[model samples]
Target: MINDSGTLAQSHLLIVDDSLDELRILKSLLDAHHFRLSVAFDGLQGYQRAQTLRPDLILMDVRMPKADGFSACRLLKANPQTRDIPVVFLSAAASPEERLTGLSIGGVDYVTKPFLAEEVLARVRIHLQLASRHMDTQEGAAEALDPDEVLLQAGIALIRSRLGETLTVDEIATRVGSYGKKLSAVFRERTGLTVFAFLREERLKTGRRWLADTDTSIQDVADQLCFQNAGNFATAFRERFGLTPTAYRKSVRAGRLIEA
Candidate 1:
């Protein structure tokens, strides 16, 4: 997801705020400095854009509707793909407590509102330089994870957490902050399986584990895995593992183990 409009040397920054006037002022100022800028009008949009754009830095307002700067920064830091991007808080409040809160939540810097053009530019430059230097030092020793792989891991995590619930690939993708098409493409490219195919495999695997390790009934297992019914689950289980759920559980209890 490279910024196509900017050259490799240009720094890309995302500005997140509700104020159109503020966006205009910041865009004008940053544009003059030859920075590639993207804008989001609220915290939610800011988080989504940050995930997709992977900007080098973010300038976010503190008291935005939907999500504030602190909440957005927390989400960014929590995400493996977007965690490394630096965030700078832009706020009208100059209180020490507010600044402390911002810094504690992974903001790299804080710039007060009614920005002084020179100061803002200077801070942006310093943070960008620091990030570049850090990347340089880590280049050969540790490679950064591929962005697609990161997205795939995030999607897998969401899927595993919600296996008991009925979910489509599109819902999983959206929950992971990506589109269905892109997630499907990445899953196919990386795993040689569609997203739904992978989910189905995982469901069957879990069912096998439950059969062996738990005393749960076949009907309950099928229902929990979102299968249509015990009959459907039994068919799928037999197809996958050459044993029906009832037979599998009985075999396990009888000390005749089958490979999971």
Candidate 2:
């Protein structure tokens, strides 16, 4: 579980990829950033590792010899023990449709080949922060509520359940509105955040779980979170979380040592 401060404290990261070169590249990148990294060369091993280690995040390659990223992602998502862990797809297939398919099948993000180190770190940071927030919301006491607070909570739940799908404030308003302005004002007053802010925060929280626990790449994390590009994801992630994604992951892993 994560704390209110959005820190995992200490966490493990799993990296799964078929290509030794790619695995090394990712390992080196994450290592430079200070993550306590473990690696699996195939999908089956990756799945097994996840079942056993329950790492904070999984960075999975889309194409593998057996039990490809998609199938593995589906299996993990279906399994209650591992379902909450985030999976991001790292692949060379750079098409909108392909990216959508990745996101549709339980992937939180996608990253094409030829990624940048900074971009990768950024996405990782954003998703980790997001995961921390989700854990906080789940574990924290539900804030005291008024009638409007009830509606806002409902809206938040709806948004969380549909993170992979597209959503808009207007759509949310239509669904939750007894009256538009009154509900919106009450929601902001109670939460001290706009409806969209709440939604974005929720998305980021979901993204963070994947980042911290899954073996998915940072680019894939960005894709899963619906960021336009890796660069944008990194910027937003850094802005939200004080450290780079790599640094945050490292910190969590380091903290885990004391807990153990």
Best by lDDT: 1
lDDT of 1 by residue, 1-260 (tens): 12344233678999999999999999999999788889999887998899888888899898887667776776676576677788999889679988987887678999998889899988888887777666656533323466577678767766675689889877776655567899999999998999998898889999999989988899999999999999999999999999898888889899999884
Could you tell me which residue pairs clash in candidate 1?
none
Q: Which stretches of candidate 2 lie over 4 Å from their true place?
A: 1-10, 139-260
Please report how far candidate 2 places residue 74 from its true position, in Å: 0.3
Highest-scoring model, TM-score: 1
Stretches > 4 Å off in candidate 1: 1-143
Return the number of clashes found in candidate 2.
Answer: 26
lDDT (C-alpha) at residue 67 in model 2: 59
Model 2 lDDT tens row, 123-210: 7777766766665566533333344545565465556656666766666554433345754676688888877777677766665667
Taken over the whole model, the C-alpha lDDT of each candidate is 0.82, 0.69
Give each prediction's root-mean-square deviation over alpha carbons. 9.9, 20.0
